[model samples]
Target: MSFDQYHEPVNELSDETRTFARMIVSLTEEAEAINWYEQRISVEKDKQAKAIMQNAQHEEFKHFGMDLEFLLRKKTVWRETLKAILFQNGDIVELGKEGEEASE
Candidate 1:
């Protein structure tokens, strides 16, 4: 397996950091899978194929959310920052600014 996830030497990183890297990779892969499904579903001729892709995409969404939650649990400031921005209706840029300030 390629160890491209580690910028630093893998031997130098702690176990927790390595685990975090793996999850980050997993999160990225899940996102990619979701995007691929979206594209495929959009052009699919068969309704059944589209529905199957949609179902698979939903699974990717769950995996992405789980990976994000795991990372957020490891980083308190990140969790606190996102709380101000996520699920809130407002100017997204303003909410992002508020999240940054709140995290600080």
Candidate 2:
């Protein structure tokens, strides 16, 4: 089997590092699926088909969120930064800037 996600030699990396790389790749794939569904839904002519795509997109969103939370749990700094940036409404860039400072 191909471990395309690994930039470093698989034998040289720790098990934890390998797992992290796998999850990172999983998260990227989920994000791409969500984007693909979005584009397909936009051009879809049938209302029923569009609704089905929307439902599938929601599943992808959940997968992406779960993957993100998993990664965040592993990286404390990222968790800290996103805790500041997520769930609040207002200038996102400003919040991110504040989060980057807060995480340090």
Candidate 3:
């Protein structure tokens, strides 16, 4: 079986690179779970079920955040760009453009 997460041969990658790839995959899965829970909660008729889904979705959010933080710590450029883009009250596109420019 092949893992799509790897673009190159697995044996050629360092242990740290493999772990990063795994964390990236995990982050993607958590985001997908959050999306699924959002849809389920939206249509759920039972309040208790919806509440449970919300709780689960919150966990996904935390997982996503931690995964992102881990990746950011490993990537200075990415962390720098996001530092400019996140938690700022400006035009998002403009901020992104600026972030990209500033990184360069």
Q: How much lDDT does each candidate structure score?
A: 0.95, 0.95, 0.95
lDDT of 3 by residue, 1-104 (tens): 57999999999999999999999999999999999999999999999999999999999999999999999999899999998899999999999999998888
lDDT of 1 by residue, 15-69 (tens): 9999999999999999999999999999999999999999999999999999999
Q: How do all models score by TM-score?
A: 0.97, 0.94, 0.96
Stretches of candidate 2 above 4 Å error? none
- Clash list (residue pairs), candidate 1: none
Window of ten residues with lowest summed lDDT in model 3: 95-104
Candidates ranked by TM-score, best first?
1, 3, 2
Which has the higher TM-score value, candidate number 1 or candidate number 2? 1
Which residue pairs overlap in candidate 3's backbone? none
Best-to-worst lDDT order? 1, 2, 3
